[model samples]
Target: MLPVGHFAGPMFIAPDAVEPESYEVRYEDGVFSLSAAEYAVWALAHGDPDRVGSHRPTRQALTAEAEATGVTEPAVTIDALISDGLLALIEDEPAARRAFAERHQLMPLALGLGNQPSQLGVFQIGMPNTPRVSVGYDIYHMWLFCHRERTLWAAVQEIAGEAQEANDAAPAGDVELIADVDDLLAGLIEALPILLSTSCGFLDPRRPSPTSAPADDAAGSGDDGRGEDPAEDHEHGGDALVAQP
Candidate 1:
């Protein structure tokens, strides 16, 4: 069992907390966007949601793992994981363990199907009584963890190897095509959210009406006592302005 107060950490992050960094993976015209940290968290949560219930390790254990993995700071890593929606804090150890296992099993399968490499690799850390998912790597330096089982890392490495093999089997022609298509697709992807937002009325740049206006007054309307229409001010005349003598 985890220590007495290990589960007492904050359940939810504050709104002002740092946002996860996002990455876009483009294939042809379709683009999938996710944060690096989120990808890590997803691997964890998808594999096992129950893992969050385990007793957290001492600061020393975390520090040792971080140093070995080049993480330098455990808090930053934890924050990034939480921000990515991969992991969560829960009060129940059994539930957390189950969740963590589920996440571990699912993540490799998902990545394998998508034909992408699994960057994060699982590792165990800390004392035997209260072992935890220590920071570790796979092909890349991405961190991974599985709190429920000590053998999870070994399984993850095997799965990662399979994923790498699948990714490697693509034809050279297909690779070039994907590369060319992704380059063209990038500009469209970056512009898409802005385009959609503008298309929707919700993101209009117009200002809100003052509180002095009637409750029914729409946003951006003028406040003249004479009830001059604000919409009329937006009308454009074809002729340029000219000075009169």
Candidate 2:
């Protein structure tokens, strides 16, 4: 349990779906779906409690949320979000800084500064029920040159490019193939940020979840041959890159 005495403390939210009505948080390889009110309570950690319009972790804030959402018990909702790992108590600003720092490695990769997979670079991330990305090579596995090591952005661009190329080879006005191309393109674009973050250890390693199992059975499962091929659905099956949301 996090001690809430420190007003300056902030916590980390997992790589989650921050939707208006609900939140899907992936932590320790498990997916937690939070109610709107609960999500509101958890969102308090994103900023200062004393800030205007930002959420504050307190009974008064809970009352207002309860009145707005009709949850009837905001305290219970808050407790549930806290315990479920969708929201965490960051302890202090220093800890908060470290948590945020860990996520910084993602920006560079997301902005198209990455390398190709000369050797297979497999990155399996996201919780089981949330967004999961599995990247691998079908064949031609060799040592990847440091200048061309696989990066999330590069992989997405590569697979998506191949898919586009396939669609181009298809006859003109081929609506089905074109639509499939669009889905692959859109999926890859959506997957870029999340995959990059996952590669950079998007989840705070310090915050352990009770529902989580050994990492060998969790996110690590992404690299295993037993898992489904991420790029199997793509028409151009030359590359193995898949992202699911």
Candidate 3:
């Protein structure tokens, strides 16, 4: 079965600014008018917006649903969306784990502090080419952990280990700090889109290629013959002014 994966980046449907009948789609760095077929397929694929991270619908199921909804050329639309990078495909959990182990791949984007850095070391984190969001300390720590550990599961394990170590080192009477593995993993998965929405992170796919460059360099290759702002050359769209809000 071909399992559909959650979008690696941010995608939201909102009212179109000009067209009353059409909808606006904010995907990655570009804003485009949404098509009925696209919306239908997307809605069918993402049954519940809140649980998209854990959900992986098969292409066939989505196509059948789309056909039921009267979406013309359902298969075509689904394939197009996947090709456009708005959707992805993975074989299964075991396959994903194997690929991840071999590649140690995770987020392909970079994180940066928002315009206003907090005085309490709680700076807002986001991307340079998109609006920055205040994702709080925990989210920031998770991103840092992923960056250091090179994978989400590994990061969670490392954090859990640290919590255990902290509790072990505490005095006999002191309260033990607890880090629930399931809760931490769930929270991280939930916050992933927010991180991706900021354009500060993305899911790294498994493929035959050279090792990745540094995140900072990936964000903006100052020299190296590439443009000053790497966001300018994004595959999906051009550079967008980072919203100050």
Candidate 4:
């Protein structure tokens, strides 16, 4: 069974004009018209839909929020949303590392870094068919690992190493860099479904190709399939390894 942390995928929700207290939610290719009670449950689970990542809510928290909002049988409503693919229940970080990331290759659909320093490395990443999303620096850095021929865990280690090197001047402290990296990895795992569904990215079973060439070699290397941006116009089909929430 999937773990308890539930998160909503990329979606847009607006109030329904004809139906009072209802919502019209657009996710991927489908539209969900949610009644007030149902919307209450979903809204509680997904705070600030405009944010790039999904809101991670525990089951108990979701139920309590639903009850507070006067939604009856809140669990039933939450389950319905899960079944409808509007919400994905993510596994805890440890389990996700074992089951998802370690087993799948995170292939980007389109990834570009922000040009301005004020943007803090965040970028508008997109898939062939899905809307672009604002991804933060940490997540963006992690995604960059996809270009290299290494496991996601290896990428985490690399990131942690970089952090360690940057702080080398400071005396050794109790900070556990791996733990911090794991926390960031958890966010990526939680966002996996939305990433996969939108075709903004995918988790491949096959081994990744060699690390991409440097920017200077990009122009002429186009003839070599290895030079293509993984995110551009790549075909997306078949069943998703990760289930939609």
| Global Cα lDDT for candidate 3 | 0.48
Off by more than 4 A, model 1: 1-63, 88-92, 98-245
Please write out the lDDT profile of model 1 over residues 44-63, one tens digit for every residue. Answer: 22222133324233334433
The residue-by-residue lDDT of candidate 3 on 1-245, one tens digit each, is: 12122232233345553322322333323333335455456545544334434553567766776777777777876777675444555443554534433333345355556435335445566455554555554556666656555445666667767777888899999766446655555555556544544445554422222265433233212232333321222223211111110
Which residue pairs overlap in candidate 4's backbone? Answer: 87-245, 88-245, 109-231, 110-231
Model 4 ranges with Cα > 4 A deviation? 1-90, 113-118, 127-131, 169-179, 206-245
Better candidate number, 1 or 3, judged by lDDT: 3
Segments in model 3 whose C-alpha atoms lie over 4 Å from true places: 1-105, 108-110, 114-123, 127-131, 167-178, 206-245
Q: By TM-score, is 1 or 3 better?
A: 3
lDDT computed for candidate 2: 0.33
RMSD, one per candidate, in order? 24.1, 19.6, 10.7, 13.4
Q: Which scores better on TM-score, 1 or 2? A: 2
Across 117-175, the per-residue lDDT of candidate 4 in tens digits comes to 77645565664344366666566666666536345655665676776675664576744
Q: Which of the two, 2 or 3, has more lDDT? A: 3
Instruction: Give lDDT: candidate 1, residue 218.
Output: 32
Residue 227 displacement (Å), model 2:
15
- Candidate with best lDDT: 4
Worst 10 residues of 3 by lDDT: 236-245
After TM-score superposition, the amount by which residue 119's alpha carbon in candidate 3 deviates from its true location, in angstroms, is 8.0
lDDT of 4: 0.50
Clashing pairs in 2: none
lDDT of each: 0.27, 0.33, 0.48, 0.50
What is the total number of backbone clashes in candidate 4? Answer: 4
